[model samples]
Target: MFLHLGGSTVISLKGVIGIFDYSLTKTNHVNNYFNNGKKIIKICEDDEFKSFIITNKEIYLSPIAANTLKKRINSQNFTEKVNILQEHPTFK
Candidate 1:
């Protein structure tokens, strides 16, 4: 799923696997946030502080759906988890 936040910026939630099993989960929070028009907000006083709150709120409210968003916001790169299906000859 891809979310376009007003401008050119976009949030992509792809290749997300749920706990217990490597099954893809639907990103519901992203849709809800966008639909509610809470993507961007304007703050007059303590702009920096308010910005932080907005960012944190976005993450706290949505964990599974916001996994990719959190990574991007925190400047962390995404790395796929190793697949269990692949066989390692060294282990055998």
Candidate 2:
């Protein structure tokens, strides 16, 4: 599973730790954490900040909303449940 983080940055969903909405929080700590140029991958086409994804590898600044990203991630679970149901004799 891969999540498209706006630009050409598509990362493995398995590696993602969390998806956060930038608008909801006023955490200067998080902003400070991204300082020093560790690697802030900007995927937002507009200057507007949307959400951010934290991974084991890097932090991503995405144009997609947190809710949207969450849906994408949870879609994996929905697919798995559908597959399980399909495999059951009762479902068949």
The alpha-carbon deviation from the true structure for residue 81 of candidate 2, after best TM-score superposition, in angstroms, is 15
The 0-to-1 C-alpha lDDT of every candidate, in the order given, reads 0.29, 0.63
Predicted structure 1, TM vs. truth: 0.18
Q: Which parts of model 2 are misplaced by more than 4 Å?
A: 78-92
Cα lDDT of model 2 by residue, 1-92, tens digit: 77777768788776676677765334555656667466667776546668877777787878877777767767666333111110223212
TM-score of 2: 0.69
Lowest summed lDDT over 10 consecutive residues: which window, candidate 2?
A: 81-90
lDDT of candidate 2 at residue 18, scale 0 to 100 = 68
Query: TM-score per candidate, in order?
Result: 0.18, 0.69
Q: Candidate 1 has which clashing residue pairs, if any?
A: none
Q: How do the residues 1-64 of candidate 1 rate in per-residue lDDT, one tens digit apiece?
A: 4432222434443422221111111234433543554433322222221111123223112222
